[model samples]
Target: NAGVTQTPKFRILKIGQSMTLQCTQDMNHNYMYWYRQDPGMGLKLIYYSVGAGITDKGEVPNGYNVSRSTTEDFPLRLELAAPSQTSVYFCASSPLAGVYNEQFFGPGTRLTVL
Candidate 1:
């Protein structure tokens, strides 16, 4: 993605509920990713897709689902939300996978599970 991404900026969920956090980019990036950051911790990759219909698990893929059905959309599904899942989620996209690849991130989705 060349420009900023778009995502739901905040969410509050109850235990056991499910919700889909959607991300979209119009710049037609081939590499899109999902990550989460807990309090005082660095970002942990959750999932990523190189292109439409191709996806792979990242470092922390538990309790989450993702699919790249189209080039412009990648939605992260949260099932049975738990307090541990509460964190700042980010969606990012890049044109290529390389050392100097530049990524554009959404503002962030702050999820609070109660």
Candidate 2:
């Protein structure tokens, strides 16, 4: 099964523009997350969903938003993007709450905001 997939492998945006990064999984997981990795840095969680119709903000959710309308899809929305939002965004998924579950990450969408 396709663990996770993200669209627009790379993108360049100007200040104040908007964009949506699409993420999907076919693993039937109940936990999905959106994380951003700055150049030479670790990942910072932007948003997450425990299940369909249940989404929540994460460590760094200031300039972003997300929705989990279905079990397989979790899309991240960036409104009025800024240069600070330029980073490699990764979409990850895991099975239902269990300490043993390992997160599966997408190829990542590299966005550069100028």
Candidate 3:
């Protein structure tokens, strides 16, 4: 399976700019998630969706939003981005609930805000 894929492998944003990190999967997974990982820190959940048309906020959803309109796409929108939002964002998915299955992660999209 293609698993999950994220675009714009690297990005730099100024203090109040906006951007969208795209994520897509070909595994037909029922669960997908967006997470941010800071240097030396564990991944922090930003948002997640159990299936198409269903989405929820996660541990660190601030400054971010998501929509699951189709089974293959779930993108993260960063509005009025701040330096604090700078981090490596990863998109992941699993065929089953994360509580019982291992998550497959994208290569990652690195964002830097100034």
Candidate 4:
């Protein structure tokens, strides 16, 4: 089974444009998350879903949105792309929280906005 997958490995956007980043997993994980990493910074969570139909915004969720329609899919949407939003986006999933399970991460989508 594919642990996690993300589309459009690389993308370039103009200021104010929007795009949806896709993420999916075949491990049937119950917890999913979206995070972004700037050039020289740590990963900052954008949004997350505990289970299908349940979602919550994370630390830095200002310009982003997410939805979990099924156990295998959780997609991230950017409303108005900005230069500050340009970063490497990652999708991760774990079997459960509060346990000792490792989260599987996607390759990441690198976005550059000008």
Better of 2 and 3 by TM-score: 2
Which tens-of-lDDT digit does each residue in 1-114 have in candidate 3? Answer: 778999989999999999999999999998999999999999999999999999999999999989999989999999899999989999999899846878889999999999
lDDT of 2: 0.94
lDDT of 3 at 23: 99
Off by over 4 Å in 4: none
lDDT of 2 at 114: 93
CA-lDDT, candidates in order: 0.91, 0.94, 0.95, 0.94
Q: What is the TM-score of each candidate against the true structure?
A: 0.93, 0.97, 0.96, 0.96
Score residue 12 of candidate 1 by CA lDDT: 96
Residue 79, model 2: lDDT of 93
Residue 2 lDDT, candidate 1, scale 0-100: 38
What digit string (tens of lDDT, one per residue) describes model 1 on residues 1-114?
236455678889999999999899888899999999999999999999999999999999999999999999999999899999999999999998988788888888999999
Global fold similarity of model 4 (TM-score): 0.96
In model 4, the clashing pairs are none
Q: Model 1: how far is 27 from its true place, Å?
A: 1.2
Rank by TM-score, descending? 2, 4, 3, 1
